[model samples]
Target: MDRPTNPTLIILAFFAIYVIWGSTYLLNKIAVTELPAFMLAGLRFVVAGILILIIAKIMRLHILINWRQFFNTIIAGFLFLSFGNGVVVWALKFVDSGFAALEISAQPLLILLLMRVLQGKKIQLMSVVGVVLGFIGIYLLVSQKEIIRQEGSVLGMFLIFLAMLSWGYGSLFVSKADLPKNYLVNTGYQMLTGGGLMLLFSPIIGEKWTSPVSWSTEVQLSMLLLILFGSIVAFTAFNYLLQVVSPEKVATSTYVNPIIALILGWYFLDEQITLQSIIAAIVLLTGVYFINTRKKLVLFSRFSGKLSENK
Candidate 1:
């Protein structure tokens, strides 16, 4: 039999993903203001990756892996970080941090559809409802003329959507991919490979590199927080949660992250939160709830049926 999980660890992990991951949007927004997007992300993850490896070494953890695992880590790094997150950071230039978070909140819907397309999994009834609500919420959120009319806003939204697709597919891939048994090692490798790729591509696109010493205090602080909390702590928590919990449960972070991002963005960055955006967030998050709850509802109904039969 499997040993029971430590409830405290579970709670702490969830808190990290919920709160820390949420704050990354604001952090990235702050950093990307003064830093080149790919370069900023590349540096953050590379540093975080190196730190994690050093920590693993200090702990005497096995850090070696087979070629297959190495290749898989590279793929995960590309899908989840290099293209998925790096592109999103690039998009943040034209979009509000909160707006980008809200848009990315529809990730579960994309995942569900990808499941159907890739795995031949059938979408349950509740999930179907969720998919519809998710689309409606997205339409409402993106259809606002003022928001999209901003220069580069439309392109940003489109790039964010593409990033979401990469992330959605990455989510499915990682669940089954043969990765390092040590979550820390896995995370470290992914970060290293992903960040390395970003660094490679940063200059190919004509992005001018600047020294970190020239960065403003706020941007410097933001980058530090992102590397420490967002990349190291929160992502480690994320990798741990994936092994312990259902993907749907892991996805519940979606519900809380956008709320935290919205609040932080409004408070710190003076980003506008319109009434329509509020409504869309409600609808969109509700859809995410439905998608996540489907499995639980089924399990509950089956248990109730068993009890009735026993009675």
Candidate 2:
């Protein structure tokens, strides 16, 4: 018998993916202060993947995957981590982080379109409206000055768009592809493959690793936090959510993540939260609520029902 998804567990998973992943942006900023980009990400994935595999072994879970699944998982990993995240990291060298965020926030709409165009899936009207609202909300949240403050080439914007496309397509591929039954095993293999590829490419692009011995205490802690909480915990939840929820709903995390990051900055870094951010949070979360609950809301159906009763 298949196990049912617990609502509480689902909510907790969403929380992990949203809040933890959001905080990772800050963690990455801190880590990259001392560590090289690709090398840092590569080490994070390889270490986390190894640790997760060890835990799975201790639990006596099946770790075997067939050849097809292995290749597919590698492809998925490349698309999501190597291409998706690696490109974003590269683009940040030229593009403003805020502008890059705006581009990545397009994933939900991209996924929704891909689902319809590529897979012939029918989406609800409310879902479309929700996605639009979510996009607008994100625009509102990020400062207008940040969006127009271009210090880089158009190539940076193009790269971020490509990253979002890769990420969206990779997510859809995972949902349909043949992967290991156990989520833990699947996540571990994906990370190992993706991170290994990044490590392979790091030297070719001339990213040399300085010894960590002299690295600051904060940088060391940031890296550890990324490996443990960001990769292992948050990514596992993300993959699991991809399996259980609608891809668009999973993409809704893109909207919630910025909110969490903003709140984290306010509380920990003493950053100021503007009135616009507060309003954007309300609008963005409302859209996510609609995306998740459209079936129950049935606003159109209720309106039509009232019309029939009046007749």
Tell me the deviation in Å of residue 134 in model 1.
0.3
- lDDT of candidate 2 over 195-302, digit per residue (tens): 899999999999988777778999888889999999888877888888777877787786778666666655665555557756766776666555555464467889
Candidate 1 to truth, TM: 0.90
lDDT of 2: 0.76
- Which runs of model 2 end up more than 4 angstroms from their true locations? 1-18, 91-106, 138-143, 153-159, 235-256, 266-281, 296-298, 303-311
Best by TM-score: 1
Error of 2 at 107 (Å): 3.2
lDDT of 1 by residue, 1-311 (tens): 76578889999999999999999999999998889999999999899999999999999999999999999999999999999999999999999999999999999899999999999999877788799999999999999887988899999999999999999999999999999999889989999999999999999999999887988999989999999999888987988888788888888898999999999999999999999999999999998888878454677578889999999
In candidate 2, residue 29 scores what lDDT? 58
